[model samples]
Target: MTTVDATAIVVTHNSVSQVQDCLSALLSAGLPVRLIDNASTDGTPALVGARFPAVDLLVNDENVGFARAVNQGLAGVRTGSVLLVNPDCVLPPATARGLVEALRDRPEVGVVAPRLIARDGRVAVSAHPFESLTSVLGCQFGAALLPVPVRKLFSGRSRRRAYDACLRPGEPRTVDWVSGACLAVRTDLLLDLGGLDEGYFMYYEDEELCLRAWRRNAAVLYLPTVSATHVGGASSSPGQTWPHLYASRLRFFARHRPSTFGPVRLAVLLRALLGTALALARGLLRPGPAARRRVRAWREIYRIAAAADRTTLSQPVPMTSRSPSCT
Candidate 1:
């Protein structure tokens, strides 16, 4: 009911409370909203349906990975702009209106990411370049191995990267990729790029989408002017998802940066292998529900990539989700 030429789609797993809170915050700020529940056994769909009767809901039988869920959610959005958001994110009172206003001036922008912060008040990961092997591995191994700044040429963990997109007391600037946690973009452009390349199961799908948009002569902007506090990874335990995250990373490397196909992919694979081995060595690990499903989801990505010519997704999307809960 808020005056805007846009409709938003938020995807959720089992985090019913977080999704509810997020919806309340978003609606209070006056944005038309819809939801796509990625098959939750814990009654997330029922709760959302009963509480927010005005929202358009798509309840799946099982979890479809993030990209597909977002694609499913987008189908019902009738407005000019479409937002892809996670259920764990709560928009600041001014965030929605500001983002809509920002979208108006930048018609060529395929996607825009807002300044994201953590609940503990730290800078959440937002507004970054393509998460290349060099970049991801740099974050893992050491900053010295690579020459250019890791996060951003200007903003690594240093004074520059840290403050480059800072929302504390200054203005926002544009960047290569905005975090997928809370991203808004034009509805038409999103469909044009095929709706987030389900090739990326969990992470880096945002990067893939933004980069594709960039190549299409569309800009991916980082607006520090508006902000959202994302209680990051509510659906996942950090330790468990690491492997799938790496797998998705490897798939990204294989699918995109083909020129560096040999050494670069090898480097990232080795790093991920080492990290997983170390994670195993530590023994403080648990495979949560999302992680377990992502294992299969990422595998599906690889399969989809391998059989690129064989598969044609012409029909409507299939609804899916896991029956088991997380650790």
Candidate 2:
């Protein structure tokens, strides 16, 4: 058995259903696993303590977002590399070892992520180009206004091609960013970069970290040779995650592409307005549980977007001398 010098870190929150399986796979593969529970109320900590006694469990008093919790686990890493796997992701031991080997062989690569497979056995789009004003607008209006075929003619085709390239087998490919759900990164590089930006409550932190790695001359490599099953949204729902998703997107633009932040903010607000209107209309016409849920979700999104400019919706945590090490 080939053992990789890496610590698998899984930051979990209200992930009782998935954490056991996630930890089981890693431990069965003979990997040192550390689980940082972000104040899970579902007895997740207790479950881990009882079932996976070998896991180095670190329990937090509060739900300190995903990035911060991961950093907490990273701080105690004694290995040369760290596997940042989500509680909902099942990475095969071979796949985990493959990621570590990729980083070990390529000194220039700071992070190597596996191709993510959905629970339904479909390949998930894991790598993406950095956020831009055009891409943002296309995602917002294009999907809502244009038909699927028509939308594909414009931005979808290019985006599809990029995703397909990331899914191709064989040699690792350099990408702008890979999903942090199942990635192996050099421990020294991750610590030197200061870990993920805590300013983001959730979302965009991975992309932001990858961007910083690139700026520091470290490549983000996507290895399609190994893949992991990611049962996404295991810990949170759309209602809980949508606002942070939008806020983080704007924050990414503000920090990396300041020139586009203003336009991106405006586009986000417009999206909120349009979504709310459509949701309301659907509710009025259909009048069902699903429609009501949609309306409520869009209304909450609009409420947040409306306050984006005046509030700290998009602002990140204030950087200090040694803080936000990735930026």
- Scored by TM-score, the top model is 2
Residue 78 C-alpha lDDT in model 1: 66
Which has the greatest lDDT? 2
Would you list the C-alpha lDDT of every candidate in the order shown? 0.67, 0.80
TM-score, candidate 2, is 0.88
lDDT of 1 by residue, 1-327 (tens): 457667767888887868888888877766777787877877898998899887778877776677777777766456777767788998865777777767788777667778888888877657665655455556656664544334356334533443455534366555677788888888888777667676555787888788878888888777877788899889766644655565565556666765544555456545545544554444436656645444544344444334332123222223223212111
* Reference-based TM-score of each model: 0.78, 0.88
lDDT of 2: 0.80
Instruction: Residues 48-82, candidate 2: write the lDDT tens digits.
Output: 99998899888888887888877877765778999
Q: Give the CA lDDT, 0 to 100, for residue 179 in model 2.
A: 89
Number of clashing pairs per prediction, in order: 6, 3
